[model samples]
Target: MWELRHRGGGGPGPGGEAASPPREGEAAGGDHETESTSDKETDIDDRYGDLDSRTDSDIPEIPPSLDRTPEILKKALSGLSSRWKNWWIRGILTLTMISLFFLIIYMGSFMLMLLVLSIQVKCFHEIITIGYRVYHSYDLPWFRTLSWYFLLCVNYFFYGETVADYFATFVQREEQLQFLIRYHRFISFALYLAGFCMFVLSLVKKHYRLQFYMFAWTHVTLLITVTQSHLVIQNLFEGMIWFLVPISSVICNDITAYIFGFFFGRTPLIKLSPKKTWEGFIGGFFSTVIFGFIAAYVLSKYQYFVCPVEYRSDVNSFVTECEPSELFQLQSYSLPPFLKAVLRRETVSMYPFQIHSIALSTFASLIGPFGGFFASGFKRAFKIKDFANTIPGHGGIMDRFDCQYLMATFVHVYITSFIRGPNPSKVLQQLLVLQPEQQLNIYKTLKTHLTEKGILQPTLKV
Candidate 1:
């Protein structure tokens, strides 16, 4: 076995440095030594050990100093904290948006109804211009102004009666013509003829194709407005419900979309609207259904106000006094046996008011969102960020009213088709059958009798 010698100080003969050679019995000790040459250099006591022995006081000592933070670093950290504190700002923004939304709904309810009518008129005018553009390839100076006046007349002719009837007492005597000739009919015809002449004249100007298109577009627009207007008016959906359904549906859809988008919106639904997601669509769909049900329930409860019930007593009395002309229409009409018996008993109840809530909801959900989608597509097509930045975090009039337009038309159609009972003539016949005029006379007679007997107060109408 090799032996190893321990080298503490100078042991080598050549340079007086430590270099102990391995001995036969110490070879295992050399193998076990793991310290490298670099470790030996870093050991501080190696050189000092060769010097004369020194006391502990011979070395100088240094004390530790405090660490100082930079002012710029402190400011940077503060800024990061402030930037992250956005909760309060977000809350304030949300509240403001909600308040403005309700305010718009309140004022816009009536304004939107007017807007719908106006859009129809304007769209009609645009269509006429489209025709002129197609046929003549350019606009006539007076065409716009003339179209406005023409559309106004047509609107007044169709809508004036129903709108005036809403506030019947405010209506002037001259506005009460139900069956009078429409004075603007000739002007309307003349405008159409003039447009035709303009189209023909364009042929002389080498723009016949454009002029033909202009006339064609004008007529097409006119037809569209006429059809839509007829549908809306005939349905008798001009009241507050017109505003409520659309507004409610849009609001509900928006809210539900937000809720779902916030929670589960991991994937985008469409590239055009990146924020829209499958989660949001599902949420909106369910929310729309809920709103529909609520609207139906509320409308049903208030059906009496929307559509009043007319009661009839004593069929014999009604028939005896009803006009011969009215009797012809009443011939096929008869009340249920039970209801007739109840009417004969002079009961107050005859017809219970009914409202179609489910129908209203179905229409709102199906048609309302299409309006929104179309508006979205329109914005995408135009390459616009939004309609306008009028409402913070929201968009413009077109953006807000998109869904409303479709919803209004849908509910109006539903009400017209199913909710409104039979014709007015039938109702009038039933009222006449009760001998309303005779009953009024008898009532007046009783009133006089009661006054003479000191049982009632007498009053005179001016």
Candidate 2:
């Protein structure tokens, strides 16, 4: 009994000696072998007791619990307690960043594309780092190198497609770029295959499970970071308006949700984000819709906002000078019965695109918040504070823009499915890339079809 007490309760003697104090009741003449074995057992326990017990200190610095600061402190800080002060500081900084972003975008679309690529790379870094820190315990081989190689391959595949799709005219004209552009997919696949072979070669017989786990992790991270951001750049090519409006709408919604939640939030919305409230959700939706409408109406007047983006080779720049599509043009619509009765107007004229803001804003407020919730769940799953403390108060760039990426994707899909039509310029650019004989065949077919429709005239002496 005294031996057990000595081995468990007593840890170490003074002067860094690995000695457990013998209890007063124990005999001094115990076996040397037993004493040494007991001492070693005690030493092992002392080293790892806290980790084994899963102490509070071992938990994530920022926990899964809701932001639940005391009422007294909140009142003391004038309701700016529990991260609100941090929120204001970050918010101001964010607005400044947005202003600078627009200034860069004003310079050229190329600059904006560079900004997006930089952000994509940074976000990928934050996520991949988290996975490495979490799963590196598996002792997987070539994990970091393989992840980076996959990122390179994916970026090459995506950006190459973008250049080919949007800048085909410039590509076909360049002798050096034609081969690369024509076989971009094959090149991307070949690069990926090389990486795949390397990963297989690095796999150990005993570590196959760990190797496969890291592989899936790398691929999933790529999907989340790369695919969504690609859609965002695609939205930019449609016109800066599509990109700006949806992103701004999400920002507006997030701000209003926090404002409303702070003042009027009572009923919790979700367990994942316990501070969220139904009041905040509804209030933000209404506010976002109003903001989207006003913003869309004001921007439609500017060619820079309403015009489709087109490359102007003659001017050696990108330009937004196309005639407003019917979507941007004003059209008559019947009002609701109540509005019609109150205003005594049978019909009202409004920019048709302004009405579309309702859908965009609706998604921004409703479905977009789920993206944030999804991110919250991901952080919680990893037992992490933030992906990285990229922004002091808010968290990482991922934390701030989780919903914005979702909104951008939705906007792109909405425009393509419902609003976008085939572009004559793009069609002509593709035709220009074909052989002369092939071009002649298309021309003959078009001429015959147009003549059959009485839209083309036969040659006649003037």
Candidate 3:
């Protein structure tokens, strides 16, 4: 669309004399023959004059090379494919890295929790640092300090609640922990109050708005990171499925989407994620659900993958059991009309939990990616390319797990609503930690209730 008709003059202008200098907002009028006839230095000066004539500040800037996907990957490959410039090499390398990440996660329950914690810390840092950078613009006092202090308070409150709920026995067996177990809420409130008072004291003239903005920013970051991560740990207590299934599903969907987009992408999915395409989104969804079912089936048969982490003092080590819930147990369900006709069977058997996995995968594909979209919007708002380039081509840890925290929340809620039951084992473990008086009282109460319901043994009734 651009035309460069102007060049060094061969002869003249409209008057057939020497050409005049171009006025402002006008393209130069000239010819090339005179420029070639003259020295090369004169031609270079004329070219510089053309460049200086126009205002280029209004032109849109190309984003930094480092921020672009191709450049990031090329650097990550250490300039591999420098000649042929194969960009897909980076995608393959990323896949290899992700495969290794899951391998470490599969090794143990502690490793899974460790992974979650690591992601949480990195995500929190990314968000808070963004807020901190903006805070200085407002000249706010103690904003960084207050934000981190609130983070600590919130984490303490959440972790305390988690331990008291999930590890009641652990808390009850220790006197110091018993006190915390009794008054955890009051202690948490006190810590929060301390931070609140500090914020109030730190407030300066005409800076209330900035302080409030930072307060909300810190809280939102905590919600996105600490709160959801705590739920992931709680899911671990239920079983690994609540943690593993959704995470794997999301990762699968992301990978499949990228591959699909790479090959067949045309229509954009959204402005926030410009590289995302309709082909990728649809492909990732179907693939995620199918993978969800298969993974559920495979992981269901394994004790370590299916069982909750529990203490085993007799063996002096933590262990998992193979007694899966009825949800995880295989059951027969009548097949659909087409499926039944194709298979020539009345029913096909599968873990009922696998059906639930379809729901998990649905959320992972459809809703979980919104978390990443939100992160994209956040970065755009700040004019940042990535949160940080912690990974070679992948941006940051937060960038990788933006969808994961949302997926973790969904899995936790799904388990609580559908799969979890009144756990008799957890209740018994709790009962074992009570004083003898309390334990006897509970026993009597249980016995009388059972007798009234006609469930007591005749020999023991007397």
Candidate 4:
């Protein structure tokens, strides 16, 4: 069996000579030479024993907390087999979670942002815990503290950008916030620099490689969890529909695929996810596309879902009331000849947003599964069944959000590339933050351009 070599304090350095006592070391040093060489010499099979041969059956069962169901429910399900029992438990939990999700949605955008932030924190914790386990034998100083510090720094930066973008009026009301907003990037960088210095200071001789590995692991985790979650919030700001459609599409795909695979699966879809099958993939694609279309059509009719979330200074709360954009308005489309002949209609009225949902759904079905596969490969690399037992049926917050993050990124890109343009409201908000003279100068320039274009009377009074 493969075994990990544990090193004592003052272990041998590159040339296998007993090294001197530990001391603070440079962040970039020659220590990696020995570490890399040793890693190359180690047998891969020994390093991750049984990972190569482990099958789907190795997944762990439900914990005691989950297994102890209500007596009434237990009695109701007692006649079923173990498989059905598990299905019932998972189904019940899934419904409960969905109910909570709807409540969050009803509470409005701010609550949704809080939910994203909470999930980001949990996902970060789960991934960092794995890193801690891998290096628990080493007495790395200040590693955990610095990892969390970096997370705070990153969140500060991203959320600061969000505030500056969305809550301009609110920030303008506060003197302290104005200064912070003016130099937010610089402050964020300084905070990160402090954490970086702390990391370098915590590095010890003979543990340089492990310390660096942990550092990289912390950063990659932040990239996957924090950055992607930030994108999700940004999508929400675009309009709740932009956020809801993509997320719902992924959920629809996941559930429909599972249902289809559970009943009709025979051909394997991929080795990474053994349970995924061709039947599921195809069913999920069609189901998700149809769901996205209907979801978009329904959400588009409601200003609450289709309007961009904006702060209302008068009301002192965020509001989503605005003239519905062209994307949300019903537009006429000419049907193809074959379709017109079959349906006996020449034209169809639909919201433009519904058309965009097809693209979102297609990507969710095709590319989104790869995100779960990537997570699966990550688990297999560490020879673990799940990230954590945070959820009863689900593995961890990270596991539930793996595909969602990927979908979030694609939605953000799609909005920026296809849906969004220079926002007059955002520009007005930026101008509101400027000095009177600067604002006046821009006003005069815009007036001049308008006059030159014959769109405004040059002599009109302000």
TM-score per model over all chains: 0.47, 0.80, 0.78, 0.84
User: What C-alpha lDDT does candidate 4 achieve relative to the native structure?
Assistant: 0.84
Query: Which consecutive 10 residues in model 3 have the weakest lDDT in total?
Result: 56-65
lDDT winner: 4
- Candidate 1 regions exceeding 4 Å error are 1-143, 146-150, 161-239, 267-275, 298-356, 385-393, 421-462
Model 4: per-residue Cα lDDT over 1-462, one tens digit each: 122333223566899997763333432455856655544444342333333344556433322323345577778888999878877877887788889999999999999999999999999998998878744523788888898999999999999988888878788899999899889999999999999998898877656667787899999999999999999999998899988999989988988998898889999999988989999999999999999999999999999999998889889888999999899999999999999999999999999988999999999999999999999988876667678878756677888889999999999889889987776665766798789999999999999999999999879578
Pitting candidate 1 against candidate 4, the one with the higher TM-score is: 4
Q: What is candidate 1's CA lDDT for residue 385?
A: 49
Candidate ranking (TM-score, best to worst): 4, 2, 3, 1
lDDT of each: 0.48, 0.79, 0.76, 0.84
Higher-TM-score candidate of 1 and 2 = 2
Best by TM-score: 4
Q: After superposition, how far is residue 63 of candidate 3 from its true place, in Å?
A: 11
lDDT of 1: 0.48
Residue range with the least summed lDDT across 10 consecutive positions in model 2:
48-57
Between 2 and 3, whose TM-score is larger? Answer: 2
Q: Once model 3 is optimally superposed onto the true structure by TM-score, how far is the C-alpha of residue 232 displaced, in angstroms?
A: 1.0
lDDT of 4 at 314: 89
Supply every candidate's count of residue pairs whose N, Cα or C atoms clash at under 3 angstroms. Answer: 26, 0, 1, 0
From the highest lDDT down, the ranking of the candidates is: 4, 2, 3, 1
| CA shift of 102, model 3, Å | 3.0
